[model samples]
Target: MKRLTSILLSLLIVGSSVLGGCKNKNTSEGKTPESSAATSSVAAPTDKEADIVVIGGGGAGMTAALQASQNGAKNVVIVEKMPQTGGNTVYATGGLNASETSVQKKLNVKDSNQSFIDETIAGGKKLNNPELVKTMVEGSAAAVDWINQIGGDLSELGRSGGMSVDRLHRPKGGAAVGPMIVKTLNENIEKENIPVLLNTTAKEIVLNDKNAIAGVKVADASGEYTIKCKAVVLAAGGFGANSDMVVKYAPNLKGFGTTNHKGATGDGIILAEKANAALVDMEKIQTHPTVEPSTSVMYTEGVRGDGGILVNKEGKRFINELETRDVVSAAILEQPEAISFLIFDQAVREKLSAIEKYINLKIIEEAETPEELAKKIGVDPAAFAETMKAYSQAAASGVDKDFGRKEMKSKLDKPKYYAGKCAPAIHHTMGGVKINTVCEVLKADNAAIPGFFAAGEVTGGVHGGNRIGGNAMADIIVFGRIAANSACKYVEANGGYTEPSIVLEEAETPAVPEVKGNFKDGEYTGKGKGNNGDIEVKVTVKDSSIVSIQVTKHSETPGIYENAEKNVINSIIKKQALKVDTVAGATNSSKGIMEAVNNALNQK
Candidate 1:
């Protein structure tokens, strides 16, 4: 089952939205956010002990734990809520972005960190934390070198949206890099003998009277427990899995198919918020263009990198295919049916993979003539032919006059034409819990929560408003290591965990429940959306108590939402109300369940 899940995850991994993560605001260097805590002050403690407790088992969390162990943290553990590690890390399909790496040097490609930084800032619309972006840019080269050292590779390089240079580095085997990186990290974890507790969910950030992190409360199969760790690193990740949160926060992107796995829900974000960590840019989500229309499958950006043009129903080129995902997505969203088609010739079809699958899945249409391809995909046949001709002319002339695209890798003149219906899907969430350069989680007042830190997709202030393609892996790697290095040093200075003489009073706010209403209730039913489709539920109320909640219909992705479904219904029934921290990463499904329950009990 694990093997099958991993295989499916690898195949489904696609584009900047699924793989890319992180975003930010301004800072001269990777300084604390304006709302940062001043010191790493400690107050109370609890029952168990470990040098560090890293939450989530994805790229950031794994890397942070390994780095900490490497730095001599004797007792380090990774507490993951799922049965296995690899959050969005296992869903990555793109290459890492680095400047002036060994691969670039060997290829004689002239690139600089500053150039990378300039493009990233521009891509992020200048809302990025200049400091964090600079850190990632500076650390990018080292990050690539580190990945290589850790049994990974950068054998192939390509260009992605919003970048002028060919800095996107692929894995050694091919475009499939997610599993390789995950395997390498997992192997490292095994070698270090790091303890990983699967199916363990972090319930709360236990703070002492000093308003500082003391320990964490976690729940596992055995029930809830506490682990007294000197430091907690929240590499848990973003909230793409929770449809309700997405709708509430980024309403502009509501109802779009999301590219995140169910576990990609914003667990660490909530944990941080409860811990007094201020979040940044929570509304900015990166929706990648060219996701397979009407499906969650994502077509890799390499299609466009190898010269694929997106044409609308009128068979006309819209925007530069090589622009940032944010720009390309906006352009596609403006088209009819919120869809377009990716047009390419034999040369592109041959070099690019995913062709057979696209064809088999009926996601792409192939024809010997542009007109035929256009007809099949619902485009104006004559206009499509003309568009192809114009594209060919521009390719030959080295200038795209219609869309002002300068990067022309090939012309769409060859025979055996191919086109795929393309649309955008909500991919990466740019907004998240704020963290400083050293990976320290910050409070609402801009102070560093002494024992709290975060990295990977969970921490914000890295990518800004728009994350440049191929930058997510680089961000996680660079900052994950920084977090570990900082955490280990922190453990040493803070000494071993000890029970303090105090009771917890300055903790986080509990999940607030709605006021009980006087409603003549027996049974009610309603429908709401899960991640992709509708979720229907039947609510049973007895004597004003939510006695039972049963899910009637749902098309949510399996494995991802099973736990979420069981959780949301159970919680509402147990609490007899709709106040609960959404099942960590399955917020959308949970919301749908709640909505259904609400629908069922319409205060008759």
Candidate 2:
């Protein structure tokens, strides 16, 4: 059964959004976010105790905590800096990679560890951790089964992609993979009675008398507190949110913005460095080609799987859209100014749901003449026309001689041409604190930091330079479980370290049944979005937990409302002992709902 779940997880790990795991405003240097708490007077720290302290709340962190509990940790805690628990996972298109599995047998797709490995190395430029990647490839089938046991259904949709077979599986609803995995992991956490601390940021690692990892000093609403734990799992994601880091790591990419969430700073890497963990492949950054250049929000590579084409200002196809992300992105970079437009007719758009939502129906600018459209986007009219002519001829003949683009079945001939201006944006950071196959953080000299572990983008060396479309979620699940199992074993072997006093604070807000309406603040329009919106919410507490919520009005897209609604309801229930689920697509709407919930809770 466990094996079956892993296989299902691998195949179905496709539907989640990338959330721009690591991107920053400035890419001048791979610098950490300027510490907001630096100038402020440091608060005196207090020491609390736990058997395991997982430093993130994504799939990896939750998995580690659950495993720790199963391994006999009486007191385990997950410290998340965000108000929410699931990091980028909640935004992921849930898909996983498995080999030689029952799904493959059922689907009649032949697969093996070698073929998977070859594909990964080929797809990623041989930059992946050979051993760790090996483990992932070999153990993927089993991992999928385990995920299914955790609440995901194995029998789902099968999509075709860069794999040798239909090894990619997706869950029903075809929504965000992050929330689904998170929901399942959270369930296991509750069933085991684990403690999760939200809106908590770890400041520094607490080293004991022996200079080994002792605990983590964190800042929360109650001020600074030290969590003394024997084991610490660093699952704080990547540095994509840190603009400085992006610039420094990807020097070629100037003014490179990101679509990652704001919370995805390289906190784990900094904390691990403070603890002397080795950082590897610090230079290898993954630049996903098709991210919305302005918003930095991802549009998933499944676009190509849905039959999109890459064309220049001339309306000519440039590279093979079906090639690996890195190759395709690099090919696109060769354009005159490191920019090109992704062109597609309305006919192809009808086939891909994600592409339609992201790129819309237009393929390029309409200017009565191709030359006029070229001038609009600043392309040389003659050059653009010639390029387009060449491309149309090649595309019509069914051969992409220029860049070997095999998936040229779709033509760019349409009355209304639309083009998405694309540039290479720093997307995923494939490097960070090094970890073993089981996700234990390895030291500079090559050994496990007994009580320290890392997962997700925080611990690098997984993919050497680039990551496959749906592979990251698989990485999280694989390593998350590893961290959890390891932590649990550590706790079972040695009981919890020590427990310190938790100074509970007074409640400033009261509770309500539910808040009505939405936060309709007409500030920003969807015409040309520039920045991500941030909202502050206060929840009313009764006895130490939230009771209910209320909201005003806010403007956001409706597609995200589906999942956001349920997430708000579930959030209310879990802390309130109610049964609520996360909405499917409406993230901002859900957030607004949470804010309303918090606001209603404040009525003392």
Candidate 3:
């Protein structure tokens, strides 16, 4: 019977691989696969245990795991459903917001935590939880220092919407802060040898008879399993990407494009609900003012904070570009077809390095003259020219006449003008599972759920109704660390993490398949689909054996693709086969590269 079971499992594996291949082919042609076909090929563990289990491997989850480890938790594990760990943090272009930071002090920019709290409350329309916001603000400076100490670059300070000072810290070149922070966190996690289970979903948060967190029920490629633990941190992000959830909370937001990654589907919220945790502010969804409607790519608020202006189809400025996101988004929605254009000159582009990505994505329309750029974007050329002339005058005079804009940093006289068609898109969800100042998950009566903690976008009350541009980063780092610390304390008070009592039956390991065929003795080029777009590779065969594989072109995320490319290519060359296992967190890139190699070998 055991032998029969092994054979059946092997057949199932082969069947899944075939289905995955078909899915990849469809994905290459720009068709997203249904959820059923997106499972990974890696086998799930039958018996797993941890002292602390963190759901989601995005910014908050990773930070919680790392801090738990640092706080002396012996066994800490992170489970992420996505092929990569960044989550929506990968899409964040703004910087980290913190007041009275060393970065701000070094730059001679004055800011106060009280001021930060006040602005955050005003942005949230006074719906924020005062205690949670106060805790976040008080810890903001240390969070900035912590990120810097963890090898992240945040030396440059800039302003963002709803900020009273230059408290937003990013890289020196004004680059997108999300990728940089993700890269830093990933590098540190690797250095610490932390275990992050990719392609693993937390199906349920198991509790003990005492109503405390006892373990987590998780599912991966092989099967469902239980991870016994003393504590669980819910860092899985918001439901901005889940259209049903979004429309359920805010009915008016239906059919709106979202700037969130596909993984922000409120998994943690569901898990918390099952645990009987309180939910708060579920209807407070905020739409960003400048997202490319077709691609759902957000043009960072830093663009407008630097000098970019938003204009209607008639080429007239309607509102202050640096207004809070909710206000700006509402203004944009009132425009023709609910669309507006983000217009900027070459000088503004030079000051912000994040714009290079927009250029690379082919989303930004550029021309040497304002009239030419306007015509390309389907706007009136004369009106746009006059608008640019007036905006230049405002910049020269250090004043905005029409919109009362406060920060006019540059004149619009530089050549090579640019414009991108943008519209308001669902960006941030301010409501989630409720938590206290210490990051403890709360019951409806305001009592802490024993052994349960939450942080980042998974928790509500940090941002009342609307999230500030850079506050999300600060919220994740500060509260993620706090949640870990609280979980560690709880474990210690409960005599630390005890061994799991539940026993699970182990599944038979499948036998490895033999290499089927030899490759032609030459170089071949082939293409496959990656998480971002097409991935092309050049495969070199020598003596009818795979010798080398190189990724010639790809649009995958920077830090993520490198790991998949290196691991998959090296494994293919070493095994001399294409049936290698995909990288844990980078499944899509791994499969894409493997498919490209397989395509290369099949050439006539």
Candidate 4:
């Protein structure tokens, strides 16, 4: 009887293991698990397959996947390593730089492609590949139209630093542009039925024996598997978040905080390097001057573009706030303690919806008068009042006599002044794998790698040594579509699409271990680190079951925090457990909320 019982127990354990491995896959909203339907009408296999595999699910990768599908690729897949699709794009607060667009025409803003080209080349310090610059400028109008066609709003026109005209396009209310773009693209991806594999990482680009693209080796909770494909687009972002990579290339930026998403770790560059792709301008990195020193939150350049001032410890206006980011950051670094304060009035804040986020994060110091603001921020009150008076006069006269700043839009004389402490932090990495105008990844000999393409921050030469504000948006949209079009053409000319059929091996599941231990019945508060800072939550329990979870305080990004809070908190309450999945594109915030709940329950 004992022997028979042991055999039955062993059988039960094996069954449980198999069942655990077969748990539900983490997919984007509106995505289905039917692999056959997602890729093709063919029968499903143990492993995944697609006609085109995009390695990153950021703005660039999402755009490429959608464009490839529209260009006749039957099966398209987006692999994102993070819990969400929006990479660093969710953090962008700038506008899209474009010229000769309908928005520019309607707004009576005069702009030309040549002017844009010249400015871009100059901003890049002439280190940019001329061909790439021309291509981007030429396609700017079309990119703007494409965004509009896909239900994205870019009608509002503004100017960014280093621009000669008011050519930056954004949403109607001067809201942050990046999250809007990502949300629109995600909606379109769902509408087109493009399958996005969340929590999946591409391990390697599997090249066939003929030195052409074959498939991509990826890993998920289920272990390693190869997604069979003919062409791959490396739309993964840059290495701004990778301290080692940043220090390796630009050692002077050591210990600087980053404004990039955690996933911007140069995975695409590493992959391209392994594939023998050439790199360019790897040493050039850009730093933004207005990042919050403690939390690394980057204040939008629009703050200054719309009428904000940088004041040193002595309470004097320093550099021209409208200058290029590099120049402004350098000026800030030259100040005492390498820190400065961004001061603006309620009028400037009203013009920019992005400022509301800064207010919500509790980072912005509020005062009804200049002296009060200066005293609160530890600056000379008399000097600050004098600086404000001088700035208001300059704004009223449309002439910056002090710093020669040209675009003084407002006087900032309104009451309820706001200030935030800021310093220089690493922002964008301007170097990566080299690519041609058609978005084909090139080798060291300047020969195109067959069936390999790259776009966005992964491929350099577009920005040269320094990228202009707002051009990063144009670069991703223009080149992402170009990369997809080229990939589709290459696949059509080279044997067409083939259905994938590969055997996948069962591996241990990495799903958050199911929450264990009974909870004591009571309300508890906990905290966790979010994308920008800490997230605190109040948990209510009833009969040892979570009754509700409320976010009492958080410093997360605006749009992103809402999504994660709604989805993650509700899931935890519904399941009465903390094994809920993080929302796509809002992974950090979701994890932070979950961690807070866990801490609350465990009293850790």
Candidate 5:
């Protein structure tokens, strides 16, 4: 298409020359068309224009992008496939685990780095990087602070299944923690004015010679384009959500279920492999003990932390409720049917709202007898009855002699009984591109890849075989910032070009409009109606930044919007790129509007 346009333009120039006076024939004449055209053309920009290019716009990507920009990377570009920036982290519960954090200090809870390290290593079965683990544990507090500074809230504290203290921090809005963190980071990212390209996927890393990083090959609405830069950070995140990758890397989970965002494929991993980056802990896959019964709704471990129980068909506690998630999941897997039940009384249910959201609490088939409940969930009635009797006895005594469950006695003896099926589900991949303490990607020979770097789940060896629930959130924010700081220092020391030298001339013609919207000046804005005509949006962009957006119409129902608007707006803000979050109730509208915005912005 671009070639076609150029061809037409050249033809027009020739026609004008014949009808009007050519510069050759009218050299003596003033202000000829050919002479005017020569003066109007400009040069294209070069790859040496920016110091660093951060790929992937998740929590890790944003952190790297923000830090790089602050550290003096005159120009920074964040490439994200989704319309928004937060990646899988936006879906997180924001419950982070860190010893000696400000929250831990305030609550007077005592913990040590050694203890944290010990638990982490043991939990991951000694497959973790001792040095990277040390860095994560020691630097976690500061990471928490960074997120707070970026506008995240850590006002509420809670506990998770693997923790020894109530040190897990929750956001102000409870379950909205992930969105809040993403929103906060987006605000900080925008303030730094880092360039973010939404709906853009990095196909491959651009190499200068044999190994040193140069730039990336990106594909967007206009098709493939090369973005040149001195350094690249791969924060594209983990491969838990990709079934194919899961089968290839961790075949043990072949038939098992998983809990991961759909986009959590191994794109970053594939690119790293192409670059010959080392992958660590590839076989260590973590599985959650409980998933939603009917579907894959991920229920946070906080439910067990607050006193939920894991019962088998027999309706009795089977394993230590406070054990590490890996242990609990393994125990469930070893059960007779490879299935377990999560049971809690009504009072416990009211306290932990996660149960309802992740399960069909209302449609529960109530039973007066444990046998009946077991029968409903397709379990052995006699075995279930015996198990329930034992559990009640344990509850009465306030002790779990069989499983050593903490908070052992929260009596399951009520008039109404409930049972939900649960099995081990792979949660996260512990393997990714290898990086050093400075967050630089290590080459196959163990040398730093000069200008190449990686962070977050995309960078491996931190958690080894297993990532503690809260540690992931902290790692991305902390290490993301670390990578940024390092990239800037490298650029400054190497004396890379400060101003972008991109040459736009003689490019194949400018691409045609694959999508439609409005573009004027350096700003682009668009308004669109959703399929149901329930949600209408006005997205405004300025100077390559999404400064403001107005959701003029909301046809969305309440409660479901919890993950929609905030996620979209936050991505736009953080990436400073116009992108929309996945539509909640109105998916078509979501894609349409976001594509429209990208269409308008990509105009040459």
Candidate 6:
């Protein structure tokens, strides 16, 4: 893999031809110039150098750096534009997807890597590079081991869309999986003293006269700087946050708010393109079916994966809830009101620990009986009763006459059933800079660009047309490791020097903000983000004390959150404020309740 002078000249000659048909544009435009003084005071660009540079701090970037270090890379640096690390990886609640892991073997879930490969190819509509998909599937179990070795947890397994078996692995904790991965990877990165440049934005990829990666230009608080590196790994994520990119690429999503983090504006796509990397499937954006309509916060597919059902306005089951995200979203959008309800009972609630948080916020609706719940949510009571009866029968017999549902893990018989209104939100961009099996960035003709690589959502061709839920995590972790291993080979073959002064640094976590001000008594609705969805609450106050709390609606777990709801309400009444210990085993729901109450009080 050594870059000889002849190869460099050959690359420089064809680089223009490689980029000729590519498209490029800034993700957004600032409407007007900043005040003239702001422009006049612009700082000069600084300069630095490295052996390897990672351009994001998400799952992919973090894994890339750790693997690179393990592979004996020195002066490996991760430059993140955000103030903190953990890009979209911090927000994913559904967890990683892998087959035949040690946990799965212990849990006795039947799965094979071939089954995983088949499902992935089918889910991606066969447009996936088979080689890339195979690589992901083969490396998945080992990737899980890698995460576990780094002190990260991937304990629980659930089924997500496009998986033929129960294989999505999440932290046993009910909270989002991203936090666990981020926490572990971050601690390891810091423990290893890997230099991380926070608030550093990569502006462009600089190439030497031979057209290989020379370095990268970046901007930060101290102004712009050049990071001369023999190789670059672009893991900066996708463009769901950029309205312009969304419209230009996936125009069908013009009106949908994205579930992507704001920083997911395809900066990596722009930067990689300048180095002759081609983009693919840029229009293939996948929308999640269960996003809370107004807030656009995702309702994790685990609900359905654990046996939740979708019902329309008429209170009847429509599509099989276990279908792929794209299929379910289309079914929902075609429904009356362009919305649907997710219904589950105590059995499902027991399995989904995170639902408790949504329940305490009142975003999930609950009721003592089916009829009562139907009346409360504007669904036809009679129709709902009949639907429940038939559904019960189907669950008992394992024969779904209406929608052809194959799996019926539990029956929805328990009282205080949970339901939430849902609509689709753009969830993932199944497209970005093109890369091959080893994760080397490629040109339009599919030739590797040598010194550049990409992993995660920032690279396309893994999940071809429509991405499945849990596969996103797998894509990043698997390819990220591959990218790192390949980069190590490149770095070892060709040597580079790093500046001693520019070393790794870690950021300290900020303290939580306390709710301020004395209470004014009034009923107000407040929404708070839960483990997997948004929770809204109605808190009533009188005499500067929370007199009562009514959970009129919610989409959280039943039994677990039920206890938390009662416990939190009583605690709020006793304390006359949201300051209270979270109920054990239902901490997320309890926190959501307290935050919602605090938000309600803040309205005063």
Q: Output the number of the TM-score-best candidate.
A: 3
Q: Report the backbone clash tally of model 6.
A: 10
Once fitted onto the true fold, the runs of candidate 2 whose alpha carbons sit more than 4 angstroms away are 1-46, 70-74, 153-162, 187-191, 343-352, 355-419, 496-510, 513-604
Per-prediction TM-score to the true structure, in the order listed: 0.74, 0.71, 0.86, 0.84, 0.73, 0.78
Candidate 5 Cα errors over 4 Å, as ranges: 1-48, 72-74, 172-176, 346-356, 359-398, 407-420, 496-604
- What digit string (tens of lDDT, one per residue) describes model 2 on residues 156-272? 433323455556555653444555676677667656556556557899988777766789988764366687778888899888778888778777665777656677788889999
Write the residue-wise lDDT of candidate 3 on 396-477 in tens digits.
Answer: 9988879888887778789889899999999999999999888999999988889999999988888998899999999999
Of the two candidates 3 and 6, the one with more favorable lDDT, higher being better, is 3
Give Cα distance to truth, residue 53, candidate 5, Å.
1.3
TM-score winner, 4 or 6: 4
RMSD of each: 13.5, 10.7, 7.1, 8.5, 12.2, 11.9
Tens digits of per-residue lDDT for model 5 on 1-604? 0100011111011111100111001111122233445564423222234568788878788778777766666477677665445667765763776777787787687877777777777776688888888887888778777777666677566666666666667764345356566666666665555555555678999887766777898765334667777788889999888887888877878876767666688899889889878877777777877875455656667666656677765455678877877888889878877778776555555655444544333434557777777888777788777776777687788787888665652566764666566777878788888898889888777888878888998877888766777778778877888888888877876775476332111212211222333334354444444332335455555544555555655432222242345444544544554654464332545554555455545656
**Poorly placed runs, candidate 4 (over 4 Å):** 1-24, 27-46, 497-567, 570-604
lDDT of each: 0.74, 0.61, 0.79, 0.80, 0.64, 0.75
Query: What's the distance in Å from true for residue 247, model 2?
Result: 2.9
User: Top model by lDDT, which number?
Assistant: 4
Can you rank all candidates by TM-score, best first? 3, 4, 6, 1, 5, 2
Ranking by lDDT: 4, 3, 6, 1, 5, 2
Report the lDDT tens digits of candidate 4 across residue range 1-604.
Answer: 0000000000011111100111113422222233223543322223566788898988899899889877767577777776566788878888999999998999888999999999998888889999999999999899999999988899898788889798889888789999888878876775555666656788998887877888888876445678888889999999999999999999999999999888899998999899889999999999988999987989998888888999999999989898888889999999999999999998988888988778867899999999999999999999999999999999999898889999988798999999999999999999999999999989999998888999999889999888899999999999999999999999899787664222212322322212332568899999988876789999887766776788898867643566577657756765577867776656888899999999888884
Instruction: Name the 10 consecutive residues with the lowest summed lDDT in model 5.
Output: 15-24
Model 1 lDDT tens row, 319-433: 9999999999999989987888888888877765434445545666789999898888888899989999999999999998888888888897888998888789888888898
lDDT of candidate model 1 versus the reference: 0.74
